[model samples]
Target: MVIVDDHALLAESLELALNFEGYDARRVELPEEPPSETKLVSLITRSQPRIVLLDLDLGQHGSGVRLIAPLARAGVDVVVVTSSTDEPDWGHALHAGARTVLSKTMPLGEILGTVRRLNHGLSVLDVEDRERLIRAWMGQEQRIIEIRRRLDQLSPRESQVLEHLMGGLTVGEIAKLRVVSEATVRTQVKSVLAKLGVSSQIAAVSIAHQADWRAA
Candidate 1:
């Protein structure tokens, strides 16, 4: 596993902590000194770490969130470690396909547990966080149902497209996986977005994410 943070001290501490837990951890300080994105990617790819511990607030200039899709595409799991209790951050992290979101304020044991759970293909969120997400999901699910009812929409293909969308699959990736043309996938995505009355893929996915569609 790898840990990325702007704070060198925190990275060192986490390196020791994770090593103690048998993670074979390495630490990287994502300071402004790093001049190239290619360098960071090369470092991470060379390390071939199974997971990355990222800090959302990387000293105001960088975003660990932006690394989510790239790392995930590289077959790595990102577990965000931050002190922010903001709902939007949590949603963004989840929407970006983070394996887990852990608060820095949480107990060490809880953090460890979350890490273990995520490594096992499970997600970990605080109870309160889960409740809040569920409530938001219920509202969104109602909205989706209403929209679908009104439009008499969501054919099997469209629904499949929506499922892939919710799973964070890009149009190109989905097309390749489904053995279809990118244009076809793009059209299906647009149709689903129009039917749901949502203007963006992220918003459509966010609704399904909060609704716990896959979890259920």
Candidate 2:
């Protein structure tokens, strides 16, 4: 396993703990200006670890969040261990392919137990985090369903774009899926965000979890 965090002390401490658990761990202290995303992509392709313990806030890079989707796309499992409690981050991390989000403020034992469970193919999520995510998911679902119910308010193309958006596809990906230009998808995304009163994609997704909008 590998740990990516700007904090040296936290990295070292986690390394010690993992070593005690019979796991090999390494730390990568990314520089102020990280190498290209390509280089980080190369590292993951080369290392191919079992799991990545990622910190959401890594100074300016925030490579941790950026890498989640790519790593997951490459079949790598990620478990986020970060201080961010932003509802959108929770949904974004999961949408980006994280298996779980373990808060840093939790007890070390709980953290260790989560890691162990994740390693063993069993999920590790505290009840509170679990419930919170459930709510976020429900909220997102509700927003999507309501929007769809009022599809007449949207142009056919906008409705199509929104379908892809709700499926967690990035704007670029949605453009390709719809065989449209990137700019069009961006426009649709902006419109969707505005119509839903969401400032970001994360909030849009968090609104998807509402039971009223859970594909009923």
Candidate 3:
């Protein structure tokens, strides 16, 4: 087994525990920048480990979400061990092909059991975490639907204006882009805010970000 986490103490502790349980375990420090897909495949090949216990947040380096799919493709199971309470992180990790997402707060015994189950090709999520992940996915879907509905209420020009706003354009910048007067752009901005039920450009932008409206 290999553990990939930024925190040295936690990695060392987990290494100790796994070794005590008679498994060959080691901690592989994450690079400052995440490795390329080919490099990652090479590392996994070299490690020849059955499971990878990964952490998403690697301080300045960034997320481990990008590692999951490649590891899965390489036939190495990934168990996401994170302290993040945000549902999207969990959802994203699972969607990217993690074996299971485990809270850092879970007991070591439970974590060990999860690892063992993965080694034996069994699903390890508890019923509660499964339901929570489902709820989180449902909530995200509903939010996207709502955002889409609100966006549908906009005129084509208004939709264009909202996209610019979410892209961090000022009223003046947007007006220049649309070849319209600043006043006209401001009017469209107000219309967008009203339709989206937001009070300001920042609020509207926040909604846009949450809904991933730019992608739409």
Best by lDDT: 3
Candidate 3 residue pairs in clash (backbone atoms < 3 Å): none
User: Candidate 2's residue-wise lDDT over 1-216, tens digit each?
Assistant: 888777788778888898899987787657667777768766655667887888888777754778888878777778888888777667667766788887888877787788888888885666677667757866765666676554445566766666666677888898888788999888877886777667987765555433223332
Best by TM-score: 3
Q: CA shift at 133, candidate 2, in angstroms?
A: 2.5
| 159-204: candidate 1 lDDT, tens digit per residue | 7888887777889999998999999999988987887678999977
Between candidates 1 and 3, the one scoring higher on lDDT is 3
Cand. 2 Cα-lDDT: 0.73
For all candidates in order, the CA lDDT equals 0.74, 0.73, 0.83
> What's every prediction's RMSD, in angstroms?
13.6, 11.5, 4.5
Segments in model 1 whose C-alpha atoms lie over 4 Å from true places: 125-216
- In angstroms, the error of model 2 at 26 is 0.9
Candidate 2 lDDT score at position 61: 74
